[model samples]
Target chain A: MANVPKLSDPQSELLDKVDVFIFDCDGVIWRGDSLIDGIAETLERLRKAGKKMFFVTNNSTKSRAGYKKKFDGLGLTDVPAEEIFSSSFAAAAYLEQSNFPTDGSKKVYVIGEVGIGEELDLIGIPHLGGPADNDKVANMGSGGRLEVDPDVGAVIVGFDRDVNYYKIQYAQLCINEGDAEFIATNLDAVTHLTDAQEWAGNGSMVGAIRGCTGQEPTVVGKPSPLMIEYLESKYGMDRSRICMVGDRLDTDVLFGTDNGLKSLLVLSGVTSEEKLLSPDNSITPDFYADDINAFFASETATV
Target chain B: MANVPKLSDPQSELLDKVDVFIFDCDGVIWRGDSLIDGIAETLERLRKAGKKMFFVTNNSTKSRAGYKKKFDGLGLTDVPAEEIFSSSFAAAAYLEQSNFPTDGSKKVYVIGEVGIGEELDLIGIPHLGGPADNDKVANMGSGGRLEVDPDVGAVIVGFDRDVNYYKIQYAQLCINEGDAEFIATNLDAVTHLTDAQEWAGNGSMVGAIRGCTGQEPTVVGKPSPLMIEYLESKYGMDRSRICMVGDRLDTDVLFGTDNGLKSLLVLSGVTSEEKLLSPDNSITPDFYADDINAFFASETATV
Candidate 1:
């Protein structure tokens, strides 16, 4: 129950300790379509200082290329598609690293958007069953027998806007009846898009499939250690030298703390200082800032 | 810990104690349009012997009228619509009995099918927002803003073929933003429509809404005290003298045992005798029969 320290001024000593910094997008670096002020400069400065950097996001609605497009739109010249590690990309990377059969027979049944399809396509994992017609009246099957493709070896659940009974039924059927691996992008309770509204996250869809099949899936996003493990092996980043910087507590903060990396929380998006400092809250960030810009306000790079 | 006695002959002693008999339809009386042999005769004999009868089913896809239609097709002349207590009817009956203000403004946001809609209409509780077009491509909102109607005082979840992200989003928005009563028709894990395939039941939909909103809804169907309490209060049925008979142990048997009523398990449906005799299983029925007809095949009911 220690008090969460708020770094109003730049803490160069803490910043200097990290070999690699994983930044969460949306709130920390950008909001929707707009980049946060001084973030572009901070990334450039950090890169010039020989500090390795990557953007880790739970947003599975977009693929790595799609995230790169957003970074490009923000005029981030150095950050390419490889630097962005989204849940979508993580899902794809997981399949490839697991060596999920290179034989032409195996495929993935996707219950998500184009981002999931794009990511799977990037890794040469042929996927089917994305964006099915979810019209309620039209989908009333006579026997309720879901068609399961023999080629589908895994079922990937992400933030599906078209998450319907048909998709869930098919997903559950594939997982329950067949020897298919069940994987989820994230298990966020509610996704904060704006200050006013919190929409149903991919957890709802994943939870529905879970409820139907009475089975748990391997979550591939934040706090799961799958993405962190990916980064650790791919970049060969030391756990002690890596820092996770983000805005959310459950996803971003827990992702860092659970994986032995330091977590830095910003008040720019979801978490307020009051809740962060509350006694009941167990998940706490190592350091807090008003925003990503505030974190490095008066710091000179170690280089 | 006790043995669930498999009754090959009539157990007149157990049947003699109960004044009312409640039957679960699908597995007990009929299995998808094909009536179980001698079930109609069993109902008629039970009715002739002065034992009151009612049908309690978790299938929310049918309204009371729709259920009556199926009953009529099966030549169940004695079983009126009033005797059928479906989860849909239970949801409406609970709302109506609670006097969920009939004043033209307050309504329920239904995330279910036409059956639930019909039942709510029968009770005169107006509803909106069900099974909307949730095609992932078209549903991307600017701020994840859900269109919550101010007049919606409650959100009812049931077996929905069109259970989609849009309906879930609206239901979550209404529950999170407003003081709306969250109600679920049932929470069956997997509704076995046929012997080979099991469809995702109302539990999946309810759990999705629960996952999105982080709020548990009041379940009105089997095993929940809502239906038992409704039946008890409405019929003034004696708890000790009432019997719940069904094939499944989870819904029907649990519904009885959880309450004070005696539970009778029929083996002609889902549960095998080995499971009933399993030492690991804690849920035990008061009596067991091969089928409904077998229960009354050899003896006369106590008048």
Candidate 2:
């Protein structure tokens, strides 16, 4: 376990003394295929100073292996594949701990991409729909998407670029009629990558399904206990001593606040000063800075 | 608005159908204590000619108001109010309209009595606490009831027999919350009578406060638009041509099903076997038969 000191609420007063700098990839390190401002240099400086750091993103649009390749292309070549954590992986870990029905014969319905679907397969939880041999895709077009069938007991929702009415309807039907338990990989309403336009993320879909079924899903990403659970299982991190450094409040700040860990919100992402003032954004950050490099430059103690 | 038919799918198919009987009260005849069953021998003998009927029960408690009153004591004396409808008025209506928040209010922080609280209240919408004022009077000695809080946006529920902690919480903070909405004047959860047993009604209290709010309530009376909205609002109903008849879906089957013309659920109080088996229980009936009295014993016609 890392010998991180326990910081009182007092420690959160300063903006520095953050030894482990975690960056959220999609909106922080890079957006789509392009790197964000000073991101590459920040990573180099943080590493040279012997500070431990990692990139954690809840975006399940790509697999861990895919993220590794993207990072190498972005010139953050020294970052290890092990440092990348995605909500899809967190979801898989959650299912594993939950003793998910993993018999090869049991089919699990997935409403997401290769990253999410592949995670289910790796964990031995069968995918109900996908291109894999065991997959049982509904292909309901845009209208049948929300139609739920009892045969599908578990629903895995992730970021899908091609969401249409049919998918929503089929998923709704599955949830309302089939009584399928629902899970979303993350709660993001939109991702900054793939252009700056807003797109519905898992939260919007979950809201629609909840409207009909009166069910709230267990989100598997940051801010959700499942992510922390996965981290503990993978690295044996001391739950009380760890801290989360990321940009977004909905994900990173929420993750830290909800789990009792310290959070550092970087100003390099989609969230802004105005958003922090809103009552709906329940979580508050422990520290903030322009980027990873500036964080260490301040050299201010957390307390 | 579409010219949709009001009967349930099964009942709608039998165009000129009228073979049984049922009823619900609250809205059909009287507002609170006033009798809407009316003064007419016209209410009896719908079954003597061999029409089958039985009251569909949603109340779960009470056995036949001991078998009938209100009308018997009010000197509209020819009929029986017990034979009109089951006390599960709110539940039956809600079951039909389990959709979205008609406004933005989601969870109902209820406080009231047995008929208004337990079974019916919990069916679809999530409820935060026990039913209010009236319900306390109804369920004394049962145990400690959950208290209501300001976080609750809507207070729906009814009557009570031993009002105390539950009622205080409801009447004080829950309703006083600025944005909170109050529902329920169907105040009489259980009406005490000449004998030891009590009869339940949602008048008195529900009616009193409604007068103050001036927000004409969506009363779940014997047969109000509220009940019909279940079928018509969702499935579409033909108001001009449809008819309802019963001893009681609430007070009378024909109440909401009546559509301003023929609302009659026959006597023997609530319902009969023929009414239970007929499609109108799910649809709408044209006429009624109380006990052995059939109103249109030898006729085949539309209202």
Task: Return the TM-score for each candidate structure.
Answer: 0.92, 0.48
How many clashes in each structure?
0, 111
Which DockQ value does candidate 2 get?
A: 0.02
- Looking at model 2, residue A226 earns an lDDT score of 70
Q: What is the Å distance of residue B249 in model 1 from its true position?
A: 2.2
Model 1, residue B173: what's the lDDT? 78
lDDT for every model?
0.81, 0.50
- Can you give the lDDT of residue B90 in candidate 1? 91
Model 1 per-residue lDDT tens digits across residues A1-303: 448887754556456678888998878888767788788887887787788888988778889999888888889978978889889998888888888985657989888888888998877788887765344332344654666687789999888777767787777778888888999888877775544567788878887887788888888888788877887788787898888898888878988899999888988877888888888889988888888766467654432
